[model samples]
Target chain A: MSENTRLRPGDTIGILGGGQLGRMLAQSAASLGLKAHVFCPDPNSPAFDVCAAFTVAPYEDLDALDRFAESVSVVTYEFENVPGATAAHLDAKLPVRPGVRALEVSQDRLFEKRFLSGAGVAIADFAEIDSQAGLDAALASFGGQGVLKTRRFGYDGKGQIMIRKPEDAANAFQAIGAVPAVLEALVPFDCEVSVIVGRDLDGSSASYDIARNHHENHILKTSTVPADVSDATTRSASAMAEKIVAGLDYVGVMGVEMFLLRDGDEEKLLVNEIAPRVHNSGHWTQDACLTSQFDQHIRAVAGWPLGATERHSDAVMENLIGADVDGWQSVLKEPQARLHLYGKAETREGRKMGHVNRISTRTA
Target chain B: MSENTRLRPGDTIGILGGGQLGRMLAQSAASLGLKAHVFCPDPNSPAFDVCAAFTVAPYEDLDALDRFAESVSVVTYEFENVPGATAAHLDAKLPVRPGVRALEVSQDRLFEKRFLSGAGVAIADFAEIDSQAGLDAALASFGGQGVLKTRRFGYDGKGQIMIRKPEDAANAFQAIGAVPAVLEALVPFDCEVSVIVGRDLDGSSASYDIARNHHENHILKTSTVPADVSDATTRSASAMAEKIVAGLDYVGVMGVEMFLLRDGDEEKLLVNEIAPRVHNSGHWTQDACLTSQFDQHIRAVAGWPLGATERHSDAVMENLIGADVDGWQSVLKEPQARLHLYGKAETREGRKMGHVNRISTRTA
Candidate 1:
């Protein structure tokens, strides 16, 4: 897309997913006086409740995609797993930010690792494993301890198993349905952190403060801003993220998950993964900063200038998973807590229902 | 309505009037996981671009009103002039927050003044004027200096005439089309200010910081939070707002516009008018407070607990009238400014296109 592709007010942004992220992207689009048209197969998608328009059809349906594209000026997705064909189809029709290349690379683990390595960013050592013998050989090279992950469609610790010893590898390939996979030498880190960065259509970039993340059952539980990492580590992580976005010629906000490893008296950072859309860890920006990650993403994709990434207050964002949302009443009563509920009808276990961002005055 | 009228996440809120206020209210409802259905006669209503559902029919259309009411759990209005009959029509089918009484009282200046006086809120001296003789007689009593205004449908300096001298009354009656009016003694005010207060279904109330206002061409130009008033005056203003809401048994956010008059070593506040819905002055809350006026209004109308009213930053909110919105690009580049545009298809002179909230750290 050309640098002159700025969207005017009242223009509709076509979003390719209809989940909470899509719901939030729609809200952010509305704040800027822009409209949102969500496209998702789920008729009951949470985002359908807040968007100006929606197309409920499978991503593979080209006719439906054409109709959706015809109604919008630009397209963006809320999930990185948008089918390559879907992205390619829309890319041919209109501008799709972060582009198809980001999708193609992040969709597979092996490709993601190679991309990070090629961009000169530090990452865990990994090897593509298409067979049981391949996994064993990679494990032997990594000293018998590594994480086996599917090359595609894996999220929240799904489609993977840990091989700590010879016995632990039994039926490991079968456990993940024998899908094409990658085995990576696990890096022992002090804590996991992530950086949310936004790249505008003009190649300018901005990043938010690093957030220290904690997980439960492999799902993100909480993200606290002003991460416990040293200033050098924060700079290193931000530089890595900028490099990756620049390397991909990416536009819009990207969340780069990283591991902060302690090396004696120094700190080392490793790129864990890259999310080419707004991530859960950046939700704190909604209440603590002038421009939220969602808003920044919309701005970038619309060819507008990126908003300030400076957060006025420190915050801790906690996701409301499944039954945990039952405590919404109490969350509402908390003085510093801002509750954001995704309009989901059902509360199945492990489902992400909503989130709360607790903010406080910034501390030096 | 009962105190148990709390709306669930997926419940829809029926909003009367699809202007900018309704648009922001719809966005706030979405944030809380509630759906918004906007009802308005204008098919191009700005709120339509943000709401889940919409009805393009006159407010007086009972058939459309009935159908619109049927699809929502609760109803609320964005404008005070929601025709008592239309409010009564919806109130009969479901709970209409702020209630019909607020609409009845606020729709007519005569009723509003009388209600304020009856509620023991300090207000300017005024007398109803139904005829030329009455206008002349009332003008004589106010030291030949008062504002002659239509008792209904007057806003932003419209439908008002100043009678400063004997000659000023020549075509004054004919100027306003000789409608039923109110003649009020003009008081020398130090400045204009407003307070936004929210009262829940259970009768509990909370108020945001007072905002000092400035007007240009009779339209609100700016509202600066932490109004330049004594501590006692702020307390007095908030107390007056709470008293008025309690008197009306109001549920939802109410904006009480007041004139701050300076006396010997004292600050006196008089109720100028009451907006039974969220007010433009409260737009500052969107960027500075945890719970914005729109969010508080939705929470109250939905019968949910009110969020905190404390502002994390000091803010100055300025309305973008007509061509002022053309400066949105510059506003977007400002690090501390948050731009909000009403999705208006056309920009006409005197139209309220949007607003910008500029914030800074609070200082004691």
Candidate 2:
């Protein structure tokens, strides 16, 4: 698809994976007059409740994948764990966005680090570990203080462990089931931030303001806009996001997480990771910006013009994880609060149930 | 069902009649974590696309009605023309909102006018005509100029005819099938306006600011916020809406259409008609206010806390009728335009396909 030839209101945009991200993505697409077809193996996926059409099929089923590609104008996935073969199967027939290369790099920790470092983006020191010997050597190089994370399928602090000392290296490595992993020195950063950027079909890009994030038990708990960073630090974050998008020739929304480290009187940015889909840290954009990150992702994949990212208000977004969702009544009654709940049947420990975004004129 | 009891996220809302209105209502329900079940005889209903469950059965099917009432916690209708028997059947089993009395009144022109007049609300002069003699006498009393309309099922100028002279009364009567009808004088009003109000199950009420409306070919063309009415006129409109709600014991969002007339030194409000559900003139609230009419209706029916009805921006809403939807590209490209299109398979002349809301900082 090109800039002039774009998907219209009735066009169907197929989404891969089914979670809160897919559900929110489908809703945004519907608001813009487009239909959504969700393909997932889980029958109880929350996205099935909102999409116009859905097919309950696994990614490995080539016949189902072919049928899905034929049914939609373009395909995009909410989760990054989709096997490269599944994406390649659909990309041969139609457009699969964020592109195959972007997906492959983001799916692995080592490749993501290399891609960023090669693009002249500053990143924490890292080394790959394929064996027990490699893990021990990498830990020693980082002075026994680093994180050991599985190369694939790691999210919300899962499939990862922290190494605080040399004695903890072996246990942390075994905890990840001896899988391929990467070890990076834990930076003494002051705060965590993220940039959500979109690249259209023609490679034109736009970015939302940096979001300051807080984590509890390694899971994102909240994201506040007008992050406590200098204007120069924000500029550097946005520039780095654009560089990554161009490096991968990405088309769709991608999230870049960074650590804001204090270097004496100056602040420095360190690339932590990249999410090749809408990120949770940017949920505040739904209430604050002219167009949300979900809308931007849909626009990019549909080959439409990128929407303005100008935020109308300052915002704070809080995640309702597991038991926290029981307090939904209060969020529902709060003024200027927009509440969203994923239609999950059961809430398990550490599972994300929903989120609430509160907007105000006050920036702090 | 009561003040202390409230519907939760997993609860299902059953909607009667499948149209664009039902589609929007279902979406709003889903946004607030509720499931929607749409029941319509037509298989191609646009609302079926977004709802969790759908039953394709006519209202006359007793078995289908029984199953539907059992499947849902609460019942609401998109159109007021729901068969009396169908509503009675559902109300006997579950809570049916805006109840049977409200439906009966709004479905009949004479009944609505009588109820409004009895509640001390100002309205246009009208007289019920049971026969040809009565029609002629009513037209003559109104200076030989009046509108003859069927007491039931009249909308968008349908099932009605204008009488400019006594000679035209017979033709007008025949045009409406010579049924039990009402004659209303064509009040020389300057402009049109409407108020969208909500009544909770507890009898607590709230109203959005009046919306100024414009119609083309008797179909609603546009609605803008901050209506051109004085403070006294606005207060009078709000009071009239509350009066109608209390008179019917309504428990959902309702639309009260009125005429703004210049009566020499004073501005007068003449109640034109009341819609038992969300009104097209209130579409501006979708972008301009904290809570939309759809949200208000769902909240009221579910017995949840009514959302704040504060205006956050100035807005103008325009409907896309049939071929006018071809300019969707321009609307999509424009900044601050939130476009919504019903997933209709085909568009016919005079059919409402979708709408666009444009917001600005300027109040005028």
Candidate 3:
């Protein structure tokens, strides 16, 4: 990559996704006098509304991606599933922050587990499976219950299945299309938490306060800042996030989702996954912190100094999924709630339409 | 006017004028899922980049203005010099918040002073000057010093001249094109302050805390929130803002700038001027308040409940002019400073390139 190091205010950032994340990132970039050029295949991309420029094209089209890369000073993807080769291609022309390796590891569950486990991080007990026999053997090793998950393109509980018994192993594997997958024993964690960390070009890094998350049907419903975890757990989460980012040689904001195992005296955090881009769990930071995770990510990608992660107020961010957005007027009526709605024309079930960050000075 | 009073999330807002305030207002509207359609004569307007749609046409182009007005649910303006006839034309198609009265009263200095005075609001003693001889007459009416100002289209101390000496009156009048003007006695004030108020369609109103201001070269340099004023002064300012908005039967946000005079036993606030739209002095609220001024304005115009204007933290907002914006790097390095840059392609001296809102929990 041609490392021009730091980017100035007028620099253009090319975003690889056009969802609400990209829309918000574009808004943040605009605030800093930076322009955003979003490249997405969807004609109805919400990000197009707020960005200075955009192109509608498939990611597999290398020539189109190159033209986009030529226009922007730096490139960043809002999702981890950005093709590694595409990022590498952009990197050859300009800086692609968080690097291709972060994408490579996070996009595949097996690679993510191997990378996290190798970095002295505690993750779920897992074994990879490529065939029916492999699935059976892994299920036996897990003893009781284990999840069979396809190693790629899984989110919001898709591409995964739970095997509760030996007989259910083959059915679970078949249900997953018998693809390359991982079988993992589920841990009884007290709560799910995530820490969003930003690393600058010089390797200086900082993490925002932990957000304790709640999921409805395996989709994130709410994220509350000042997670109910103890101070020691927060310290451990911060340290682990720092270590993981350094290990990947990553720059830009990365979210670390973990399961907090509350085994009495042996309270520990087990790494569930790594999202090498801004995560929904950190949405509360937009209202609670001095700098939002989106702004921090933009700053990191621009090679600017990392902003403070201190929480200025207590906040709870709730996702407005599909019909939940029907309550937008009520959300608007709430004096302390800050409403952010993605300008999406469609409102499909299970789709993230918007979110509200309710802010207060009262801490947990 | 359509009289579709309550604007839902998906509604469109059409804005007149396309400067930084228009740009910021478009951005705020986007956050709430409302699209902005801007109409301005400048093709290079900053507001165009962030809005969903735009019409580049002169305000006198009645057909173009009507078409633009037809596409939006409501019409609001960023600058009061929105050409009264053009505003009236738009109002004929849809409800225009902070209506024609706000534009009429604020666009002309004489009308503004008269309206405020009629509402029992305190203001400087002033007289109208239609010619050079009229300037001399008004000068004599005021004992020593006065400011000669054009009745219309004056901003940032432009189209105005300070007549420090009696001999300067005719020259100042000629300098202002001998246009219809207002010559006001220069009050010996202690400081300048402003308050931003939002009034909803239902007449419910709220006001952000007073902003203490400092000017350099007739341009705003900085505004500190929770202005160092006595409780009575703050209350008086709030009451006056509410009274003015209610008197005009206005909706959306209005900024009232005042000159504070220190008396032997009383502190007085004299109305200097009123901005019908979002004002630069209220920029601090973006970082310090629960709801930003822009957001409050959007909510008010949308006919949703007005947001809380309570200040969450103390803040000092500093305008970054042409050369001052070059210090963006240094500002970015300050962890707690929130930077907002207007995306103007060129950097001209005295141009408002951006501003920074540095926030802290410490109150006044």
RMSD of each: 1.7, 2.6, 1.8
Candidates 1 and 2 compared by DockQ, better number: 1
Best by lDDT: 1
TM-score of chain A of 2: 0.96
Interface RMSD of 1: 2.0
Q: Interface RMSD for every prediction, one decimal?
A: 2.0, 2.7, 2.1
Which lDDT value does model 2 have at A296? 92
Cα deviation in Å at residue A10, candidate 1? 1.6
**Residues B1-364, candidate 3, lDDT per residue (tens digit)?**
5374878777899988888999999999999899999999999988887888999999999999879977998988898888878988888878998788899999899999999999999999999888888888878778757999999989899999998886677578789987899999999999999999999888899889999999999999999977889999999999999999999998999999999999976899999999999999999988887688888898889888898887778789999988999898899888679889998889999999999999886522
Model 1: runs farther than 4 Å from truth? A1-4, A263-265, A362-364, B1-4, B362-364
lDDT of 1 at B95: 90
Report the lDDT tens digits of candidate 1 across residue range A202-292: 8999999999999999999999987877888888988999999999999899999999899788899989999999999999999989899
Q: Give the TM-score of candidate 2.
A: 0.94
| Chain B TM-score (each prediction, in order) | 0.98, 0.97, 0.96
Report lDDT (Cα) of residue B109, candidate 3.
Answer: 93
